[model samples]
Target: MEWVFWGLAAFCAGLVWFLLKIATTIWRKPLQVKKFSEAQGISGPPYRLFSGNSTDITRMTDEQNSKPMALSHDILPRVLPHLHQWSKSYGQDFIFWFGPNVRLVVPHPEIIKEILSTKFGNYPKPPTDPLARQLLGKGLVDLKGEKWAQHRKIINPAFHMDRLKGIIPTIVRSGANMLDGWSKLILLGASEIDVQKEFNDLTANVISRTAFGSSFTEGKHIFEMQTKQMILAVDSFRSVYIPGFRFLPTTKSRQRWNVEKEIRRSLRQIIDARERTAITEKSGRYGDDLLGFMMSESKEQRRVNVKSNGSLSTEEIIDECKTFYFAGHESTSVLLTWSLIYVTRNEKPETKPFNGNGFKWKLALRNGRLQGETRFTHRNAKRCCSVAFLPMKLGRLSIPAGTQLEIPILAIHHDPALWGNDANDFNSGRFNEGIAKAAKHPMAFMPFGAGPTICVGQNFAALETKSVLAMILQKFSFVTSPSYTHAPLLLPNLKPQYGAQLIFCME
Candidate 1:
């Protein structure tokens, strides 16, 4: 018995030492590596071996807040200090390391335009983690190459101007319903409202009605699961990306797998039910909601395949349906939320409204809505409208073929040089004349992105935003509340860090 006890103690000691060694190695490995320096006209920090700026990126907010700065000045730095500082130190075209990978920060409008247009195919999407892929599925946002092309081809017609106009009533009706709910909440005298959540619900409803031809209450289960999966996927990124990290039988991985299974099962049920109903009815009465269009397209594709010896598999159709549901929902919600924040911050009070002439001039100047008078020199440039696109030649830079270039839309919209001193100011009047005259560069105001891969649901999103905002504006006045945090953080999409708190007084 004494010999056995001694052997067990020895085994435990050895295990402790082995675990300690592994921990030490992980701690010592560098998270980022800077390949070049700002002094050399290369962007970002010098890459550390393994971590590649991960430590600084993670602790950015804490560090930025330790110093004194204006709220606006500190906003971007607190969230993405590396990108901000690097953009300043290195000229517009520079590269930075992000955890053993180089991310080229293309800040110039011309460079951005080139990436979005001329050299589009050169930069494919970066590889998403297996967990992310599982959660998001191979949606249009996640797809690349031939797969993406196929998705674009099949779904493009659904977003055509005519098809979109058919869905306007759906957007308007949904917006009206949302406004009625808000009215009831206001009547209860709620002091502060979280506009972010309001928009989420409103957009969710819009997506459900417009995409699924059903109420959000019906699709709430699927949306909830997707939301959970997104949160888990983002959290899982903290773990080291070891070889086959995804395949490892870890608790988090297993949880994600289970969540994904649930999502897939739920989605399959919805698709199956819709197909069965379509089959039994004989008449197509669902109209142009996203699912209806997709079903119609699938049927056509099937017929074609039968005639031509090939057709899209049911699995492919299901995947596309899932993609539309996710993308169509999330992107529209984010855009509407941000647009609301912008309009609220910029709108002058009713008492302080500018005179008609002044208002017209301001609107024209802000958005470049007025026609003609397009010529201008760099130095003598008056405040042109805030929205404009310009064409320029961008010299070539080394971009790996498969690199997924992220066009930081928010960053571009808020760029100082392009938008003058008050670039960060939220002024919708900047879009008065439309985006064309807003900036010296035409590509500056790409809210829905530009080029071929621009969001397919842009019109639908716009109609939803316009309808909701119009309804809200007609009913209540919105102003930023004291409880509102100014932090605009990106959790896959840009959102208010602490939620958008606003006061709603009856109009």
Candidate 2:
């Protein structure tokens, strides 16, 4: 009986010791990081225990997004209220906690350049979380080191300027198809159309045809599943990063898992079919599409050395395909939508054909450029998950090792000091002088990212945008619908809350 009592006492003491260790880790780690940040003269809103500054961020974001605001080009506050507020208080370089994880906001162009252009070994993509891994997979965006090098080499040929230029007609054809639908709707006396959805469909179709060598219908299911999964994944990001949160059988978790499974299944089917066709078919039409280029390159890699170090497996290829679709589709659609919104607000509609000669056509393209300049509608140029193991000189300070940094793109874009007092205004003329002189820093205008790892499909996206917009401008004149609201929703990207409602005067 004395032995049993002693055993119980020992067990209790051991449990207490274990709890203390956990408490020490949870409490000391963040404080240590915070102390390091403060030592380097960085400060932000004080963090709370365990939750850190997440509650405050959520409160600020929810408050800003709850109400509608006036239609204005200065939307930095609406889209990123927490970052904007903190920037006002803490200046360009400040510290914030992503749920106890310390992150430094390095908005200064010099620092951004250092982060992006430095050796990949020193500053790799920040360690991807489980949620990100589940959604994005280990694609080029998430990969690092030799695997990244290999993927980039293989994917480079597919996005060559010549290859992208060849797809111009397909973009025009896709745009024309959407316009045809709009015409039929107009005949049925439909005067109003949500151009947001229209553009989304158009871009998705463009990606489907260009990347997969398949029409939109053939791959629409994959897009649908991915879109749903992305939304859930974005929502999950805001939650506290507790270990094992993803493995729980919660409704959201289960749904995300199911959706991801479906996406992978669909992508596998598409890849399998393409591989079979490549083997069986004699036509060189396969060379015309991105999938063909990738597959061909991958096959050649295998032929040279079956144990080649750089070659990607079938699963990796599928991840890359999904990455292309997600990156290509939503961003281009947002760009087109915002372009139309800005034009409707700033310029008068033209009834005549816009063949690059019409006043409104030129005006539209200029506004498109401005829209790209001011909007953080797509992936910001922040080096994701990148860290320094040893102290590195960043501007005035030696940034501490293990410091996670993100370039505050939205903050810099709207900074009056950099872009002048009229930075907030919708001035396409600013870019007329070209991007070189648009801002104080040459790297200020990074709509398509910058540095060595800049977007591979930027040229393709640009040509596609130009062709589609030119075709649309030639067919219709449009104004913002009466019901249009100026609420910019940030679902991991800046977008309209009620959609881009437009009254199209189709001719």
Q: What is the number of backbone collisions in each predicted candidate, taken in the order shown?
A: 33, 4
TM-score for predicted model 2 compared with the true structure: 0.87
**lDDT at residue 223 of model 1 (Cα atoms):** 69
lDDT of 1 by residue, 221-284 (tens): 6767777877777777766667787677788778878977887777677777777777699775
Residue range 187-211, candidate 2, lDDT tens digits: 8989689988898889988888887
For model 1 the TM-score comes to 0.77
Among the numbered candidates, top TM-score falls to 2
TM-score of each candidate structure, all chains considered together:
0.77, 0.87
lDDT, candidate 1, equals 0.60
lDDT of 2: 0.74
Worst 10 residues of 1 by lDDT: 371-380
